[model samples]
Every structure is written in C-alpha cells, then in structure tokens.
Target: MTDKVSEAEFLQGLIPQLRSEGYEVYLHPTAPVVPPFLADLRPDAIAIGKGKKLVIELVTSESTQQKKTRALANLIKEHPDWELRVLVVTSASRGNELQVQSREQIQNFLDEIKLLQDSNHVSAAFILGWATFEAIARRLMTATFEKPQTPGRIVQQLAQEGYVTPSEGDFLRILAAKRNALIHGNLHDLPQKGEVEFFREISERLAAESAAA
Candidate 1:
C-alpha cells in the first residue's frame, strides 16, 4: 500500500471486513449528513452500534501532530456520542484495525418493523412501527446534535440544519407526539391506522431520499 492508492486500498480492504462483523457502517457518506462540529473535517468512515458510534480515522504517523490527527481527537472529544478509534497505519506493512462489536438487535428490529408494516395486526403495527422509526430518528439526532434533545426538538434541529424542510419537520413533530402517546398508553390520542400509515410513509420517504441524496 504505497503511493496515492494506499488510502483507497486501506478503505477497500477494511469496509467488508467491518460489515462482516455486523456494523451499520457508512463510508464517506455524501447525504443524510451533518459534519462533525469541526470545520472541513469528517471521519474516514462511521459505524453505529447499539449505544455507541465509532468514528474511524486512518493516521499515517503519531510522532507529530498532523492537522488531521489533532482535529480527529478534538472532534471525538467534543462529540460524547461517538467513541474515537484511530488506526495508525503509516507503514505499508501495518495491518492493524479495530474489530468493532456487532449490534444485531438494531438490524433485527428494523426487520421486524418491515414485517409489521405488512401484517394485518393493527395496534401492534402502529405502535411498534412508529417506535422503531423513532429509534432511527433518535440515533441520527444523537449523532448530529451536540446535546440530547426531545423528539420534537430533534426534528427541529434537523430542519434548522437543512436536513429536513420545515413542513416535513412539522409532520414529524406530530408523528413523534403520537408515537410517544402510544408508548405511554395514551390510546385515546393514538393516531388512526390510516394516519399512522401516512406518517410511516412520509418518514420512509424522508429516510430514503436522504440516503439516496
């Protein structure tokens, strides 16, 4: 791994190896993104697990404080949500890398949500479906925001950051409220089946668009 090809070779060798361990890893994501608080700096890749996010950095040398190496440490320190893991791979023969633990439950829950969406079970579908989607939103918010926020505030932050439109944010706020009420057994305030589906549709669209953007 020498020349300009080293970085690409490193990332290519590492990606599937990481995925094989069951991480929801993203590589230099182009959309559905909020950069780290540090300007002009982004992790080489990110991996999300149960309650932890990993920011991966490839450093050539640690003997000196290169701009990127210093910035990477600062960004990790600033974002309490993420754990920083740096691989010092300067030498061409270096093969060291972090073996991140898996978060299979999250993937399982997402699969369950898809199944619920197609099932005839009404209340189970609505309640679990919304909760699952909310879990996703919460994960994104935790990754983006500096501090914890309420559900509505999460949507607000997304909108303020230009990730979501104001109209979409309004819709999500109402949806989140209904999801919360459902979780708390406020059945009377629960959205109707159609309403629930509508919210899910909109949420799915937003997720898909952002992923594809």
Candidate 2:
C-alpha cells in the first residue's frame, strides 16, 4: 500500500494543477451523487469545469472487472454531467513495466475522453499515472492559452480591462511557479500552501467572471 500522507499530498497538488487549467474541481470519498443503497462505490478524484465534469475512480486493491463495470455504470447515471474515467495508479516499483502499464492505461483513457468529447457528454477526460503528472500539467496549461497570446499576456490584458484584480495578478504568478516546478521536476521546491490557496482564489474570480459573462 502507498503511504496515505504521500497520497494525500499528491492529490493536494493535483487540485491546483487541474484548476490552473480551468477546471472546477471537487474531492469526494465516493461518487459525489449516487443512490444510497449502492455499497462499495468510490472515486479517488472528481472535477467539473469548462463544459465538462469528470469522475476518476482509482483502484488500489483487488477488484473484479465486473465490480468496476457496475460502479462505472452507476457513476455515469449519477453524474450525467461528468465523463467517467478510471485509473489504477499502482505502487509497482518495477520501472519499465510500470511505465508500460501506465502508458497503456493513459492511452485508453485518452481514447475514452475523445469519444466523450465527440459525443458532447463532456469536454474531455484523462486517466493519469504519477509519472505523467508533468506532461498532464504542461498540456493543460498549454491548452489554456492556445491563442496567439501567452497566459501572462492574457492576464495582463484582462487586468487592464478591469476584469482581474491585483491579487489575481499575484495568483497568476503562483501558477507560473507551479508550472516551473512541473517543467523542472522540482515540485518539492514549489510553494505548495500558497499555490493551492492562490489557485482557489483565482478560480473563484474566474468563475464569477464566467457567470457574469
């Protein structure tokens, strides 16, 4: 079993990463909404934002394919707004084999995301392993600023337009710090506490902006 503290810390970091990419995220011990009678229902992470919602059920113990299938079905029914994704982030210490397995899982998950996106059930979904963290962060942040303008530039423009606050400007800088950590593999050196708080603050501001728009 993986250390609970480490797992929690990892998930904590994941929240800001998703938020920086413009996702409204939530945490849950089980499917956020489901019929009360269904036992053994849980998902490690759940996030909703930007025209999409997602449920990520992480498998950490011995489980049957049938069980997983059933849970997935119930989850889909419960949160129709969410595109469902499953991941098994293993503690397999073997390097090459672990990498191969993770890649296969992620590819399959991406395929599902594409299918959902095409069907209009969700904007996208992704199943990720620990090693893919950096790649995922980079992709999400990159997607956020796909226009001809950089994120910093966009933020500055928005500030000039009175759409973002000076505090929001500082939050954007915090995002830059997180991005740097992702790119440099220095997550330990990243400002964990401030990054998360600032991310939430900026997300709230953006949500208000979106609502007003």
Candidate 3:
C-alpha cells in the first residue's frame, strides 16, 4: 500500500501514455522549490518530457483548493526547466479565475449550435450561443478592463470605450435585455437570428483582440 494510493493510481494510469510519447517519467521527484499548499498536501508527482518538467497534482472531485492550485501552477511556470508545466487532474469545477474559455472552445460551441440548428433546435442553440458569447465578453472585460457586476453594464462599458461599433453595441444591449427576460421566465424576448449572429461576430473580434494582447 502506498502512502497516497489514489495519486499513485492516477500516475499509474497516466504514465503509460507519457512513456508512449517518449518521456522519462519519475515518481515524486524532489523539487528545488515547493508550492505553498497545506503543509501536508504538496505536489503528487513530476514528469519530465519534451524538454520540460511537469508538476503533477492529482485532485479529487471534492477538492476546493483551486486558488492554491493556480498559484502553484503559476509558481511552477516562473521556475527553470527545459520548460515548465503544471498538470492538474481533477473532475470538479474550479474557480472563475480559471475559466477563460479558449477560441477552440468557442468554435466547438458554434459547431454544436450548427448541429442543433439542423435538428430544428434553433431557439435553444441561439440562447445557449448568447450565453456563451456573453461569458466570453464578461471574461474579456474583467481581464482587460474593470469588472462589471452585470452583463448589461459590461456591454455598455465596452461600448463606451469605443471597443464595439455603435450597431454592435446596440445589439448587445438588446441581447442583455433578452437575457434578463429569459432569466425572468420570458422566452419570447430571446434574441433573433441576426442579433445572435452579430453577437458571434463581435465575440470573435474580442477573442482575437484578447489573444493578440
């Protein structure tokens, strides 16, 4: 029986894949620096591959130490390795600080919408698409600008900064209204197809700008 059997089990399951990729895997290699977690719960293991050192943390579904996990990840990135990486394996929701949806994620969502649209689920797709777009917008605003308490305020602030065209800004305001209505149990106020498309276009632009920054 190992001291941390679950973590060992996780490494056992994953190491074969790392070896398949030609990495020299190690179990619990000692580090020059340790992340500040609870004194007892440090990194579970380490993997060296492709000229980088990966600090591995095996977390369960009930784990709640996300801020520390991220802090440790950032700390790992700041150090020297062939290159540095942190592998956090978990099956639970992390904090909002770690929830920036990537461009590929958004593209996958759009693809799903296309599939749903073909199945005559247009309204459902549109609603979900707007929610996703708004989430991106809110994340962008909070990261690059002041965080607003509400979606409408975030859109308005973006417009005020000349980040959005007047037409796009107006459309976003409409979507915010629709979101409010939807939350209040009114489906009739959902955005139209063209409006949702405009949100998509604006969201894509914002995402590109964020990446460039």
**Best prediction by lDDT:** 3
Candidate 1 residue lDDT tens string, 84-178:
55443433543443121122333443344344344333344455444444444544444553333357776777788776777877877887787
Q: Backbone clashes per model, in order?
A: 0, 0, 0
lDDT against true structure, model 1 = 0.55
Estimate candidate 2's RMSD in Å.
15.0
The predictions' CA RMSDs to the true structure, in order, are 19.5, 15.0, 16.8
Q: What does candidate 3's lDDT look like per residue over 113-171, in tens digits?
A: 44434433445445555645654665566565322236677777778878788888887
Name the lDDT value of residue 165 in candidate 1.
77
TM-score for each of the candidates: 0.40, 0.35, 0.47
- Candidates 1 and 3 compared: the better one by lDDT is 3
The C-alpha local distance difference test score for the whole of candidate 3 amounts to 0.55
Error of 3 at 60 (Å): 18
> How would you order the candidates by TM-score, starting with the best?
3, 1, 2
Better of 1 and 2 by TM-score: 1
Model 2 local distance difference test score: 0.46
User: Clash pairs of candidate 2?
Assistant: none
User: Which residue pairs overlap in candidate 3's backbone?
Assistant: none
